[model samples]
Target: MSATREDVGGTPLPPGWAQPAHQPDAFEISTTTFEQRATETMARPFARRAIANATDHAAALTTARFVGIDHDALRDKARQIRAHAIANLPDYLDQWIDAAEAHGTIVHYAADESEARRIVAQICRDEAVTRVVKSKSMASEEVSLNSALEAIGIDIYETDLGEFVVQAMGDRPGHVIAPILHRTKDEVHALFSTMAGRELPNEAEALTAFARDRLRHAFLTADAGISGGNFLIAETGEVLLVTNEGNGRLTTALPKIHIALVGIEKIVPRRRDLAVLLPLLTGHGTGQQITTYVTMVAGPRREQEPDGPERMHVVLLDAGRSALLGGEFEEALHCIRCGACQNVCPVYRQVGGHAYGWVYGGPIGAVLTPLFRGQVEGGELAHATTLCGACDDVCPVKIPLHDLLLGLRRRRDEEGCVPRSEQLAFALWGQVWSRPLLYRASTAVARGSLRVIARDGVLSAKAPLLRRWTAGRDLVVGRRRS
Candidate 1:
């Protein structure tokens, strides 16, 4: 992918420019089809096991400590803030543009991934930069920025510990918050030893020290720093970087040039919004009052500052997101990347992120992949969820994730994206139900078929399509003729 370096200028698309396609036929299969298939096909059983072990199910079930804080009120406020920002996106974008410019930061807008990568590469070329340090930024991931930079022979180091581990292993992050959540201690020890060119202890502190020693050198020598913005404040042109690790601060401050890659929807109207969001994120995520670091950078170091970057750049990427702003999927933009949805997601809990075959996973991934990549490439992702309401309930912004998953399934079906076997099965069932006599006769036949398959009152036959349902559980067929 190449990045583009263009100014943000153009008429916004008409509201609902590309309505998400609807495919009613795709919903015939149960929502578990994709996840079930993924579980059987995934190559890394150790990774899946690691993820299951890391996320404590019983701990997640413990009641969140609201403690005089009104979760409902906070959610309402957050929703309003996101809704307002999206509604006036163009205006706030302009405000952000002006303020960033006023603060001596150059802002670039890219319409797609290639364009975005080209722009970043060009910036690196212009600066004659050979090395860069990066903070955790999903926008950079979205644009595949690291690969693009590496293609140009630029050494880019991911500073976040989890990101660093995944980068060293040449694996995409499995979880947004914990990129290395899928790897066990032994795997991490192996990866670290390989990367460090020596054996390192399997302890977390030792692994961290190894990464820190390696990255500290890069920080001092890097020509530029690249980061993903958690929240972009339109009122001040300030970008918020939230992290449990201190690397975000170091990367942004040490480099000569600091470039932030942010999606347009990340903008909030004011800084005060951070008050509610930061605590909520910490509490819901790792059960902390605050992360180790929360840096709000407005621009590069000024003439008076003793230590900071000399230049700053903010790239606003609108790769298929603006198109989703006012449509049925608009609520998706309200996502805070808290991973709460993923944490509680039954599908995600089972098969994990790679199974979705996309970057974003769980409820959010189901909604986003299809919308961002269009129905054909990403539409199949909708079938990964179990329509469980857990994701929606834990969402800090109150996005209706379950309903959106169902809607996407409906859209995919209408678009004829469903499998042929599924279509045939549902069609045959529909035909049978449409005729009362045939429906009764089919019921009778089904009963007879059940009797043939049943053993000791339980149907344990390993039928082709029904094998998945019966694999680990007993299914008892009703004997009543009705």
Candidate 2:
């Protein structure tokens, strides 16, 4: 089935994985540029619009009411639960395998992204699938699954509304919970009109209706369905999917073959843990009693069921998660994708997702990127945050996000990954500070230099290597007294 303009409208294509401009070797350069870009972006009308939606007073009040329990106590309990699960991951993995296999589900293990892609591609080729419908899965994004599938001549359709928009626009997700939050209504209207070959309304209801009508056909005609698991229950061998949209239900149930891709860290010891998490996710993400759809698929449909898939496959991916599990950074595995960090983050609130130059954004991205790609390729992303404790405050699983970012920074420093220029600057600063006379002389020179550069108490002229800093804001110089 071909995707209609209505179906693909307003959604950009998935973003190609690439490094962003402003390559900074040292934390100081990276931090400075990050601050500059974040400040500029937040000032834009578009960024303000997106922030309004997330920080809506009504929504915040509703969420506060639902999670009426003490925030600190709940966070502590959730932290302990995740800690226990991570500590005993191996045992849970074994249990998950045994239980899932018992229910006739085929399980595959992948060591990395390439292997994971190969395994999923082989499955599609073996099944002779040409088209697949998929639910939203960050694991899929991490592995670039759609590109891998397309490389093998398979057409994949994203069933989630936000993901579908992103897939069509060919852009990476901007936020975990609200992927298209960076876009304005006007931009979406223009995109939809181009795809639909006609004018489309900018109203939310009209846009949603157009997408629903377009995706309905893909659901009925797809040969296979793919999804990412929110939780893997070891006790019952069930994979749980939590979504605010009903599209997940159709994506998983309507196809002939069903496949789930999950990171190994998603495993939970029992089904009951969901009791605490379901409310937490809703409270932290969208403030609902429950997501619109919560699905638990144990295996393929039984003889009694007439409408479910016949074959079920689960691919459990390691992809650096195993190495991180036993390491000091293991706390990152507790992430539940509630996106509380991004919402509360000053940096993310300003610059949005594109500045981070990765699939994940905000505090979680800082830690995950470095770990996934190693400090050499993704070390710069680690310095994107201000080390604020807001992320820690809102995390349902209570990951110590700021501490993790600091740890990554230390690792980056130890590896000598920092730029030579920044290193030299710090070394010089240290030398001057060691002697009182040298420090005083340096301060005197700085004061004189500021006077020379100042124009009416503001330094507006672009200084050498300081052009970016002066581009937007004025730097005021101190006036001399008689």
Best by TM-score: 2
TM-score of 1: 0.85
201-319: candidate 1 lDDT, tens digit per residue: 88989988877876787787788999999888999989889888888998889989988889999988888988887777676667677888999998889887889988888888999
Kindly report which residue stretches of model 1 are placed more than 4 angstroms away from their true locations once superposed.
Answer: 1-37, 40-45, 57-63, 431-482
lDDT of each: 0.77, 0.78
lDDT by residue for model 2 (1-482), tens:
54332343245433431111333231111333445546655667676667656645424744575555776776677777778888999899899889998887889999998898999999998888888989999999888888789766677778788887777667667888788887776766766566566788888788777778657767877889999998898888889898888877787799899999999988888888888777777777776768888998888888887788888999999998989978879999998887778777876766777666556878898788889877765687778778878888778788988889999999999999999998999999999999999999998898888777776777874654466667545788876653
Worst 10 residues of 2 by lDDT: 20-29
Worst 10 residues of 1 by lDDT: 3-12
- Model 2, residue 437: distance off in Å is 5.2
Over 4 Å off, model 2: 1-45, 48-67, 434-465, 472-482
